[model samples]
Target: MRTIIIQKRRQAVFIGVLCVALIGIASPASAAIHIYTIEVDAALSRMEVVARFAAPANAISARSRDAGRFLLDARDCDNGDQISNRGRRLTISGNGIRCLSYAVDLRSAAQADQRNDLLHASNFLVTPTVWMWRPRLGGDDEIRVQFRLPNDVQVSVPWRPIKTTDNAYLLNASPQSGSAIAIFGHFDSSVANIAGTDLRIELLRVAEDIDAAPIVDWIQETAYNITLAYGRFPNPAARIVVFPIGNTPWPSDSPVLFGRVVRDGGETVELLIDSQQPMQSFYEDWTATHELSHMMLPYLRAEQRWIGEGFAQYYQNVLLARAGRYTENYAWQKLYDGLERGRESVPGLSPNAAASGDERNSRMKIYWSGAALALMADVELRQRSHGKESLDTVLDQFQRCCLPSQRTWSGAELFTTFDSFLELPLFMNLYRQYADAAGFPNVRPLLGQLGVAVDDGEVRLRSDTELAEIRAALTAQRYTGGPGK
Candidate 1:
């Protein structure tokens, strides 16, 4: 990480720094606060932005990965010097400049992809990567963006809301797992406070006019499901984006066509729903719960995706069973079926290699190897500690200590961190044993001991086994506190 040298200058100090309206008075953290005032036209086709920095910066950039395509114009507000972007970074001809202005073609940016075509005419979707341009942020530095729009026009961003004011957001530097979206125009969005966290949910207006209540309630319920793992959602103020589509360009008739958790400026759960499907199906789908499960862990590297995906895959069923959405037998059967597919996936590929995209043919292995390890660890913790500790408790402590992490971590780092919260080391040992092994993390024996039996090809729960108590407890609801409790 390069240390950001807030380019020192004596001349620009007088222009700003005393009265940042959003920030009362510039403290050390706010001394170099980047301020952006964006004005959107009535038609919402374009954006005109004027930006001011507390001090000179060596260079300013739009953190979005593909900012160049949608940017119409940018110039140094101080000297009228034309500024250009070479990729994501803005190219300034001379020394660091404190003031600069830029413009974004919102409509064109939304039209760049087919997904936005289904969105209502009144509003459009634009990933912040192209629109927001500012100085690169380091630790403690912040950006205050105030949006000025025509009447009835609103802005939704994956950033902390400035409760004291309207249409303003405070953007902080984040690990940024992926690009976050910003919507401009009319939309139905709300905030649900669940388990000590605020989930800012935005249901994009599609042409179908689906009832927002059922969808919004389902999102809130799914997010609440994430809390069953540890009594809280991972990020304090994560965002959820729901776009309803009848026939998506992508293939899938499932209630949830696709879902993902992106940790850009902040964490956001993006779900593409086939709103044409009955609303009841939404409650039964696993994709949203799976995506929300991802919030429990920080973004891991690409190679370690098996751990991230695998853990989410494992928890999705466990949490659902705990929520009573799935019976214990159904959850176990699903886990059994998933593990069988993983075992049958490329036999020679290590979990690490499969996840790193080497074969790309081992999707099941990439998604379930970590789950096998999770189950083993959970059973071992329960058996050894006599019910005192389990995977859930360790994860709960982890969330209290280091969630909403500011940077990415490796599988070893995550496992080791989990071990740190325990009396005896467990995670790293499991990581070393199976992460790079050519074969899967064999949990069939453990499963058998846990009273999960395979009769022919089907899974049957045996309540007579010694470890049946442990198996039952694994999917039992641990938290009695409700959403706001």
Candidate 2:
């Protein structure tokens, strides 16, 4: 039935082409596209959205167009009105069309009917109206929208009925650029509201520290490092809302101390950092940079959570060292410390076992410990490849191949990809042992190759070769403190 309907519409569009051409293409012709916009006001914790079709006057009716049924693809929470009721609303309006039936992606028929009725009688014609509520939990939300048009004009928005898939909408159609799209509401929040681009963000508050110049400089430096290493912005043109919550008495794990990413509305990335933390210090700045890196790995796809977390951790140090903020020794020391801590947490956990899922126990072993292993793998790979092909290149390739989608890769898949970039398969074999086994593999020997020595829980240089190389790298780069320090 769905295929038949599509075929009929295709045929109708073909026949209507001659009529459309004869009517002249000067006036804006509505295409059979889907149009959607989400508006969010963080101050009030409210949101709204409107999705409708702007078709030509010769289009069909609601019944003919599948009874106005639309798919709601929401993430981060259950797909229903419970979350949407929290200061969120959805409104629909069109000419000569009344909504007949509505269906949410994962919601039951009863729930769908209730929400649909709410929008049916509501005043959706009002601009900047309520669309839908964001779920309370911090994650992502999407809606698979289906609607009807009065005529056979232009279908501008592409219909995406799957919740897991991203919904793309053409936000702008200019003569110069032709067309620009907003993916999964991952539009530029700064300009989304003004342009009705289905992307929005709110600044909760600025950092209390008037001397936030250091933090800002650190952010820019991190961005610069990403570009230098990968030839692209960590989050190119993406919206990042920073909230500076002043000195909190509690620790970093406090709910108020952490930031959140609102995945539902447009790919919104929120960061909440404690101003009390010394922003000038390598520790504090690294935290900020690491969190910010999450914006780039938007989909949380890598089965080895360490790929995301570990890379961010490694880069935080690399960028800081490059910017003369931290010495190469300091950066390597940090990596060494992280590795030891991870090893202690899970004595014999294999990398494969660690990368399997996101369970709490698994996360500790996988996200933290696994991250340390990845760093070791990276260092080994760099040395083997004579620094010509480092982990940065591997990540760049991975980003090109696997990012922006919540696709998971198994341990084997990860190794295969990494092996493709390397001459020897030593790293692959090592990675498999740690990843697939439940026991931890010995990485102390690998660190030896880099001329690093671990003495009674301390990571330091064993000989002049390692010490000289590190010193040279740092001296050549002129290692200093972070920006504005």
Candidate 3:
């Protein structure tokens, strides 16, 4: 099962490959190797990066597609030729350049980052999209970035770590889901080994003198909780960045305030938390679980974001119930309440429209519309296979074939891929019926059949219904059998 990466994130994969083939200049395929060595200053104020290409390259630039993001003070390493044009693209000579160097004014970049100013410790974050400049890696192409850091300083990057080497990582092609961040200096970091996976955890230092032990423990526990999904976490080596923005201008009630899974160079879960809260509060917050669950699928297109958000929303409660944090009745009640909110919000917008609509108006619809679809598909799959098939098993098969896909996918594409793992198609039918309709996915009757009854805005679960066992199985935790854990 080779990883299949469709295009539309960075330089569009097909176009890039075609460009490589056209702009041959007779360069060998092996000449595509790029080695970037970066040295960080002790003050966390600046970085000096040197990129050495195996063969001369004509065009080399940062991976960020956004305008106004460019490397600073770039120059040819061989000669003192400066890269004067600073409009995002970096090229030395029309002929080609073998070695290039650049300097990063880290303090400025960190200041530009909204949350970095809140980090009052020895650490500061400047997203790598600003500093990591290199050529496009095509077939068999690779880039190795080695970091030379001061003592007591640790670097956290969204790239695959080279186990044998220190402070080195391999950056391959990725969906570039959001700009992946790079943290430098004295950030508290560690590796949490859970379910045969090694998750790198970076806890950003904040104003308060917080202990990192309990917070890391809570993260490890949360990761373990997600393992109950289909027996293990999705990505084997994912990065978790914990930003502790204590009671500041941006205030949030949640212990884990906000969490997002970004798959730039690799999958990284960024969690914003209020460190003043007790450890138990973190466990109780659904933010971390919701974010972690996002990794179970590929990055969906921004227009079809409901699929990702809804799937995560659906799993957050179900996984919580399976982990015993939420009782089955409570989970059903939560789902029922969420569906009501979604159905009531954005009167004429469909799930697709809601997902692409203004966040201020379509929040509930965007979140729960997909949840409704997930629930429908899960129940249908179970009913079709007589409890032998489920969203969990389908996702498990997907992980075996394609879990961390390197490209953004349409809602139809994602569902079609999932349907491939079954005897009959399931997700696309649901998609076609409700995706563009100017109404929320109608699942109320289905809920009734599944033994979910609502009385006076409260959910009551009944076991005597036709689909009672399947309803029960939805929240029941299955044994983590076999090798995944």
Which candidate has the highest lDDT of all?
A: 1
lDDT of 1: 0.83
Candidate lDDT (C-alpha), each: 0.83, 0.42, 0.80
lDDT of 3 by residue, 5-94 (tens): 221122133334433433433334564667777877788777877777868877777765432343457777677588754456764558
Q: List TM-scores for all candidates, in order.
A: 0.91, 0.56, 0.88
What TM-score would candidate 1 get against the native?
0.91
Ranking by TM-score: 1, 3, 2
What does candidate 2 score on TM? 0.56
Q: Write the per-residue lDDT of candidate 2 for residues 200-223, one digit (tens) a residue.
A: 232322322245444444444544
Which digits, one per residue and each the tens of the lDDT, describe model 1 over residues 1-485? 22212221322342243234554634474445777777787888888777788787657777766788889988777776788889988887556888877788888888885667778787788888878887878766777877778998878998877776788777778887778888888888898989768778898998646589888888888888888887778888789999887755666757998898888777888998988788888878899999999988899999999999899999999998898888888899999999998999998989888887777679999899988988999999999999999988999988889887778899999999999988999999999999888988788988899899998878899999989999999898654654555
lDDT of 3: 0.80
What candidate 3 gets wrong by more than 4 Å, as runs, is 1-31, 63-72, 138-140, 249-251, 478-485
